[model samples]
Structures are given as C-alpha cells and as structure tokens.
Target: MCNIVGIYHTLPCCSSLTVSLRCSLLLSLLKVANYSSLDACLNLRWPSAESEILPRHVPKGYFVMQVLRRCPSNTSPLTLQHLKSVWKDVAGDLNVDESLLTDEDFLCCCGSSSPSVNAILGGVVSQEIVRAITGKGAPHGNWYYFNGLQCTTTVEWLPNSAISS
Candidate 1:
C-alpha cells in the first residue's frame, strides 16, 4: 500500500513568488508528515482545535481547518509552541504583516486562483503526491518552483546550510 501523506494549502497569497513557494511547501509538508491528505480543499466549514488562533466566527468566505499528525517513530512532540515559532519565523522571512495573517484573514486568497491555473497546477501536485507516497519518485525533496506565467515547474533540493539554526 502507498504510504499516506498530508498537505495544507491555505493558499497564502502575499505575492506570486511567495505563493508559489508556499504551495511547494504545502506539498513538502505533506510528504514530511507522512499522512494522507485531501489537499485541504474543503468547501464547507469545520471545527478547529486551534480555535483561539482563529476568529470568533468564520466569515462567509472563510472556514476552519485543523490538522494533526504524528512523527513516524514517536520520536518528538509537535507542540503548539513549536508551530508558533515556525509560523513566526516564516512570517518574518516572508515580510508578512503577522497581524493580518490570522486564520480568518489568511484564507482570503484560498480560492483566488483562476480555474485554469488550479486545474493544471492541481494535477501536477496531485501526481507528485501520488508518486511520493507510492515510492514512484522520491518524496518532495525540500523546494519546488512553479511559474504559471511561463507554464513551467522546477524542483530544488534545499541545503541544510540554507536553513537557519
């Protein structure tokens, strides 16, 4: 059986560049977590355990998403503190106004892509996801690039040296 993997595509759209990077990260995060996913493409509201970080009520165009995963060997914890730090670090690097990125506000761009873009890119990501889970190809390495304008895609292996300590 193909090992399962999970993905979270909140579709952060600070800009095209960062959006592409974030999309790649969504795919990579799925592979890293090693859990099956539905691409977080829900069209309905749902409950969230991190409700405090979200708004009191989900706006009409908004919904809740919560994901929980386990480390393959039960080797470490995925605590709230760890996620908070990671989010802060990523926000700083992305030059995002952290305050504007709350769960309710952040999802503003979730379905903003053109239908054409979604069809093409969605298939590409889905195919890669299957390949990664079934051992047809290596799990999403560390980075990828998708240039919708150029109709091209590229994958990059991120070096540990590039990640800050």
Candidate 2:
C-alpha cells in the first residue's frame, strides 16, 4: 500500500476536532517566537532549499516524561524523566552513539531533499500538537528515523512496561 499519513477516522466530533478530513489530509500550524496569536505570528522561509545534495537520514529521539491525568501541564519549567522502562530491553544499538550518525551519513545513503521538506516538518509537528491538546492520539515513541529526501518516516515504540517486565 502507498505510504499514507494524516487524519482518517470517521466519527462525529471527529473526536471533537473539527470535521472529518479524508484519507490523507496534512494539517500544518506555524508558530514563531514573539508576539501572540497564531495568525499574527511571523513569516519564515529558507532562502535556499536546494543546497542539500541528497536525502538526509535524521535520527531523532522522544519520550513521554510524564503522562498527565489531565490536559495541560501547569508548570512552566518541566523536566524529562527517561523512559528506560520502555526502551532498555530492545532499544538495541539504535541511538547508542548518536555522535557517529551525521548528515554526511544520510547523504551517502538517501537522496537529495527539496524545499517541501520544511512543509513536511510543519505538518508532522502540527499533528502531534493537535493530538496532545485534544488527546485524540498518542505522540511518537522514543525513537524515529526519517529520510528527508524520500520523505520516508519511521517511529520506534517500546513494549508497554505493564506488559513487559
């Protein structure tokens, strides 16, 4: 099957989040450091989107520091409590040494990137933020790898602690 992303649930309230979007609908929201209001934010664009020669392999990490029983976090300065319980057993050598994984490695493996990569980033971030605010879906796991050129993304999730050890 073709690689598909975006909202695809068909139910009233669409989980109380606007209307139901079709199979693949990319939603994006832009935010900048400064003023307030979503619409009144600043505008930014890459001067040169074609500088890169190929698809870049970007290895990233994420974790749920804390799962709140409520919606928003009241504290301003939050902290990260590692999810070792979820990743330790099978995390393998994934991000064991992040130092060695560099842009050069990706260009050597994947293909070149386009200006649209930024658009992809915006959409993914927006999706996660929406899920967090509305509690409609779960965010990414502790690990993920993306090929910017091909626009291929993969997420790595650990076994639920309750079901594991």
CA lDDT, every model vs. true structure: 0.40, 0.35
Write the residue-wise lDDT of candidate 1 on 1-165 in tens digits. 122232432353656676667666666644232322233322112233322223322221221112212122255455544434444654454333345334433332333456777787688788887876664444553434454445666543322112221
Write down the TM-score of every candidate.
Answer: 0.28, 0.31
Worst 10 residues of 1 by lDDT: 62-71
RMSD to the hidden true structure, all candidates: 20.6, 19.6
Q: Which regions of candidate 2 are displaced past 4 Å?
A: 1-113, 157-165
Q: What TM-score would you give candidate 2 relative to the actual structure?
A: 0.31
lDDT of 2 by residue, 1-165 (tens): 133333433333333234334321333321112222322111111122321211123233121111121114454322222223223321232223333333433232223345576677778778878876764644564334455645678753322111121
Task: Give the count of colliding residue pairs in each prediction.
Answer: 4, 5
- Candidate 1: lDDT of 79? 50
Which candidate has the highest TM-score of all? Answer: 2
